[model samples]
Target: MDGPSGSGKSSASRGVARALGLRYLDTGAMYRAITWWMIEQGVDLGDAATIAARSHEPVLTSGTDPDGPTIHVDGVDVGEPIRGSEVTAAVSVVAAVPEVRARLVAMQREIIGSGDIVVEGRDIGTVVAPAATVKVYLTASAEARAQRRTAELTGTTVEAQQAAMATRDTLDSTRKTDPLSMAVGAVELDTTALNLEEVIAAVLGLIKERT
Candidate 1:
């Protein structure tokens, strides 16, 4: 699965994995884990040279289970901390580092090789797993994406959430390495008028057709 932040890739991929008895991998969370680690180490977020030099320092381990996907950095489970506002704000910048992408992409590929899994990320279909069996790119209107995000996090208006998501979209799509894009022959599903269940069902249908 490949799409921007708030495009329903994470939730739909997890649901599809659960329905198909496959493991789930959230690549964004892995990026966020690295961001959280960097923040803890007091690394300058705006310093690309420094961030790239130390990108390989953190040991990121992802548990590929549909029931309870977990992410750990340096022996500590950081499922919650990685989702903090601070981490979210810095992840795009840290993730743009070529070294960071190389390190994490290797880790992600290693995990995917272990077994059947639905890996979700901005570039999974295009870069991480180009030969994936089923590639579904989910998209939605900006307003719908913002509303969904606002519902997930409190104290944020839909408009405000949408604006931040737009910024992340620009960064993720324009980044030099593995930019967010639909792989060739990827099935594009517009979920602007559909609910989560509808999106999951559509993905499952695509898998069935492909299989």
Candidate 2:
């Protein structure tokens, strides 16, 4: 799966994975894990070299289960912390580093080597798992994305959330490495007008037809 954040890629992928009896991997969480580590270590996220060097740090690990995946950094479960505004703001820079992609892609391949996987990220179908059984590129209008995000996070105004989501979309699309893009032959669906159940059902239907 590949798409901008808040486009229902995560939830849809999870639903499709469950329906297909495959594993679901959230690749954004991996980048967030590294970002959390960087923030904790006081590393300069803007410095690519520093972030690359720290990519080798034995600080990241993920649960093997597909039904409920977990991520740990530096022996601590920083899942919640990694999703905070601070980590979200800096993760794009950290994720842009080639070293980070190399390490994370290796881990991703290892995790899905012998099992079915419904991996969701900015570049999974295009770069990480080009041969995946099913490739889905979920999308939504910018306004819809912002609204969804605002609803998910409390105390966040709709305007502010919209602006932030726009910024992240730019960062995610223009990064030097594998920026957010739809894979060739990947099915692209605009979920801007669909409810969660409807989107899930659509993806499930796609998987059933494809694999």
Candidate 3:
């Protein structure tokens, strides 16, 4: 799976994984985990060199269970910390670093190699796993995406979330390495009008047809 933030990748991916009896991996959480670690270490986010140098220092582990995935950094469970506003705001910058993406993409490929899994992220279909059996590029209207994200996050208005998402989208799409893009032959699903279950069903239908 590949999509911008608030495009229903996480929810739909997990749902598809569960229904198919497969493991689920949220690659975005991996980036967020590293970002959380960097913040904890007080690395200068403005310095890409520093960020890249320290990117390999932290050990990241991802739990693949679709019911409840977990992310840990350096032996400490960072599932909650990585979802904070601080991490959310800086994850794109951290993930944009070529070195950081290289390290995490290696880890992601290792996990995917272990078994049949549903992986969701901005670049999975395009860069991380180009040969994935089922490639899906999900999308949604900007307003719909903002509303969905606002409902999930606390203390954030739809306007703010939409603005932040737009910025992240640009950064992710324009990065020098492993930019966010739809894989050739991948299915494009616009989730603007679909509910969660409907989106999942559509993905499941796609999987049935393709696989």
| Segments of candidate 2 deviating more than 4 angstroms | 64-67
- Determine the backbone clash count of candidate 1: 0
Residue-by-residue lDDT tens digits, candidate 2, 1-211: 8999889987787877777677778889999998888888899877899888878895677774556778998788877888798998888888889999999999988877866777889998889989877788999998899898888888888789888888888988998888888999899999999998899898888878986
For candidate 1, the per-residue lDDT at 189 reads 93
Residue 111 in model 2: shift from native, Å? 0.7
Pick out the ten consecutive residues of candidate 3 with the lowest summed lDDT: 124-133
Candidate 1 residue lDDT tens string, 1-211: 9888778988898999999999899999999999999999999999999999999899888998888999999999999989989999899999999999999999999989955899999988899999988888889999999988888998889989989999999999999998999998899999999888999999998888999
| RMSD (CA, angstroms), candidate 1 | 0.9
lDDT of 2 at 154: 81
**lDDT by residue (tens digit), candidate 3, 1-211:** 9999899999999999999999999999999999999999999999999998888899899999999999888889989888899999999999999999999999999999955999999888888888888899999999999999999988989999999999989999998998889899899999999999999999999888998
Stretches off by above 4 angstroms in model 1 are none
Which lDDT values do the candidates have, in the order given? 0.92, 0.85, 0.92
How many residue pairs clash (N, CA or C atoms closer than 3 angstroms) in each of the candidate models, in the order given? 0, 0, 0
Order of all candidates by lDDT, from best down to worst? Answer: 3, 1, 2
So what's the TM-score on candidate 3? 0.98
